[model samples]
Target: MVEFTDIGDVPSAEVDRMRAVYQPLADSVRELVDATIRTEMDADTVAAVRAEIDAATARLRSRQIDGAFGVRYTTGGDSLAWGNPVIGVRNPIAPPLTIERDLEDARGRVFTDFHLGAAYEGPPGHVHGGVAALILDHVLGEVAAHADTPRFTGTITLRYLRTTRLGRLHAEAAITRTDGIKAYAVGHLADEDGVTVEAEGVFIQPRWARG
Candidate 1:
């Protein structure tokens, strides 16, 4: 699905306003998801809350865009992909990673510091391997993509060293090299203790961009 709408060159102030409006909503929804899992409320109360939630969902659906909110960029180069699954400000499913670029490095290095709570668990008390892949894939892809040669993942390989605890974690990636239309990158996901998952991937720029 895709969001087919034009959000013209919105100014930075307007972008901040948009974030103010939607990020909070996503925060509340994210909290609700967490609460829904841990809540020990009475059955009656749970049913009542479910009813209210249903009503709220209906109200929101009453007036909405047609498809997924796709990435939009400003003339200044700022981007808003608020519905993205990993970092979308408007998506509760996201850990909502906060990625930072290392300007001093020449590899287009990027890192994210994020936390995963009860909602992202796979094993008894650990985060899912797939979740780690999802984060690393996006991070690696970000580094592999160049301004002149936007790319897509061609292959990704991951190594699970140990179980990732569901808590604060750090991850980063940097492009190692590029060959014509392809870029290669490496990254890892880690907890306070040490690295838990490492990844390497190749991202290829589409042929259309070669011209």
Candidate 2:
């Protein structure tokens, strides 16, 4: 069995090069997902496309490592969490989110310019509310995890301000306040028009969590 350790084991220069190569492939796969979900075709045509997609997925799966893509490190000093639900590099299910963290201000932001195909449509032509909430929760959690004070979500509340369209979108979060054991945060999801969903959350450090 090939066991891997920290990414720091990998040389920084090598990691950078690897990322540059892999990122484009990941982006292409994301586009494939969007196209698959939104394609409008007759029954026979759709079936043929599904078969092709299945074959392509199988080919990729043949080269994948078993289980989840856990945090991996190289012999140098590079690290990557390619299976992170919010920012995994190879996960087609998640939007390409290059999360930026402002440790000084305790803020997390992700700007996604991906399309939400029919699979994400809830109403006539709008993105699903639940999906929006999921993205907000993940973004807020990342913000709270900053300061090396990671906490799990204890509660989250979301308000749907407007219908989110299927095109490009932006999401941002910031720490509002922090008590001794609880961190309060607020986030917003917006599009070219304006804010669509606003969220507030309380994250708690578990009893055993080290500060």
Candidate 3:
């Protein structure tokens, strides 16, 4: 297994340099996803492109270490979760979330900025409802996990107030209340105009976690 370390222990300078190098690669992958979804190539050309992509994927895969990229920290105290589904550096499926967290407040607040592409479409030019729910679940879970109180989702409820447009979008989440082992959180997804979806969730610290 590949041993993991948190980025927290890494030198700030090294972390900055690594981010500068890897971020552009991540952005390029993101653009590739967009291009793949929007391309209008003919069948034979598409097949050729797919074969080339497969070759590239195979090459990268061969160079990668085995297993998932678990969270890791360097000896210098910098932590990195480079494979995180929402903001992973190497995960091509993620929407490249730039999540911001407010750590000072008792009820933690989390926000993310991202753009949805054709792969996320539902009704015509709008984003899929399930995709919105997935984003809310992640943000709400983060609110529950903020400040080291990591909790697992016990229940979630989502209300689709409107069709979310497939473009730049904002999401926000905050812990609403907590009672004993359970934490309640509220979250929303919005476009430039206003809120499109709202969510409420309950999270529980597993029994082993309390010990």
Candidate 4:
């Protein structure tokens, strides 16, 4: 479902300032995730690092929200989806796809080029099938939302052709057809070899929009 909170009172300047301050921390946390997976330090060093991590975690928890981060909008009509798992700039777990709106022959297309590092591996050197599904769902949802009225994912099907390797990858989704309040779209995940997974999804207008 689409959610955008109004931060009309908070100066846009402060919003940008907070984002600039925290985004790099998220980037470092992502690097920390990769390092945690590959580190080969001595037991003492690991313990020392863990202590520092614990202290940092405690400090961060001292002033934190009790719920998931919600989408916020700026006065200039910009949305900040900073907590979204697929593309949240503030989320350390995101492959962080920056989907773009491109039209081919006058059809709306949403595409993103991203990378999956060590933290996302499920099968040795390949990306997890579930992760691929997650990417497609979000990508397809973007396409579904770009039409006259926004939509939410109703159902999605994915077909795995070959293993998706962990490296630079591409994904795109485009609406093929629509019926009433429904939209159908197709997309895929690809490596240099070609499409590794194919996806199609059914999206429907929210109940509020349906009426």
List the pairs of residues colliding in candidate 1. Answer: none
Ranking by lDDT: 1, 4, 3, 2
The C-alpha lDDT values of all candidates are: 0.90, 0.75, 0.83, 0.89
How do the predictions measure up, each by TM-score?
0.94, 0.78, 0.86, 0.93
User: Clashing pairs in model 4?
Assistant: none
lDDT of 3 by residue, 39-58 (tens): 99899999998999899878
Can you rank all candidates by TM-score, best first?
A: 1, 4, 3, 2
lDDT of 2 by residue, 123-193 (tens): 97898898898788988887776434658899999999889997787888888888888888898988889
Superior by TM-score: candidate 2 or candidate 4 = 4
Per-residue C-alpha lDDT of model 1 across residues 72-189, encoded as one tens digit per residue: 7776666787898899999999999988999999988999999999999999889988898999999998889856567889999999999999999999999899898889999999
| Candidate 4 local lDDT, 66-121, one digit each (tens) | 67888887676667889999999999999788988885545588899999999999
Poorest 10 consecutive residues by lDDT, candidate 4: 1-10
**Residue 132 local lDDT, model 3:** 90
Listed per candidate, the RMSD to the true structure in angstroms reads 1.8, 4.0, 2.9, 1.9
Backbone N/Cα/C clashes per model: 0, 13, 17, 0
